[model samples]
Target: MVEETIKLAYGEYSDLIKDKRIAAVQALSGTGACRLFADFQKRFSPNSHIYIPVPTWSNHHNIWRDANVPQRTFHYYHPDTKDLDFASLMDDVKFSQNAPKGSFFLLHACAHNPTGVDPTEEQWKEMSYQFKVKGHFAFFDMAYQWFASGDPEKDVKSIGIFLEDGHLIGCS
Candidate 1:
């Protein structure tokens, strides 16, 4: 089961591994995936912190915090606008520049819970570039891939963007 999961998780992109540039793991689901990553991060990089989106799934904060990973929040949802605060989010990504570079960032791949807001493809492209420039690790939780368009892969467009930029990402 473990090997199958790993293969399924990474096999689609054989090109990535042939280049000796990718590592990955299998997770049970969204919560399990987040916990596994949190544990790995805490074990290897005790001083590092994980950034969570404001108004994210309630379990996300608990998952990381329980694993002893320091938690930080980047501006995400805008209550007034009922949508993504793009400018603030960009600033938050830039703020990671001052953080201990190479920190972890948790991103909802699609159907962001509670708000149902997602970045347009162009925004995701910019975000992928920002993660590249900032050297931040992106942890994608594609818990609801069917939410955006009733097509799983279509909802994963954001993850595709990150992959195109060669970001080392973990997904369930």
Candidate 2:
């Protein structure tokens, strides 16, 4: 099941999988996966903080909090236009002085909760570039992988973009 899941999420022909670079474990659900990752982060990167988007899934706070991981919020939705706060989000991801380089970030791969606002393909590409520049780690919560586009391949475009850019991402 883990092997099949990795193929489903990362592409069947993914070089990462072919090279046996992925480390994975089975979890009960998205929440479980996230909690495990949070605990792993706390144990491994003790001094690092996770940057979560504002207005993310409500349980995200508790998951990280219980793991004893410090948290910070980055811009995501702009209520004025009822759309993505792209510029502000980019600034937070790329230029935030408080967040050190190589910080961990939790992102909704598709069908973002609460706002249901997903970034455009171009926006995701730019985000991938900026993340590379900042050396940030993207940890995608992909529970709604087939919700946005009704096609797993299309819905995971954001993750594909990050992978194509040579990022070692985390997906649940």
- Using lDDT, give the best candidate's number: 2
What is the C-alpha local distance difference test score of each model? 0.81, 0.92
TM-score between model 1 and native: 0.86
Those runs of model 2 whose alpha carbons end farther than 4 Å from true positions after fitting are: none
Best by TM-score: 2
lDDT of 2: 0.92
User: How well does each candidate superpose onto the true structure, as a TM-score?
Assistant: 0.86, 0.96
- Candidate 1 per-residue lDDT, tens place, 1-172, comes to 7555444445556576677665555567668877998898898878888888888999998898899998988888999999999899889888745444687888898989878999999999998898888888888877887678887657778877888787878776
Rate residue 54 of model 1 by lDDT: 85
RMSD of 1: 2.6
lDDT of 2 at 148: 93
Residue 123's lDDT within candidate 2 is 99
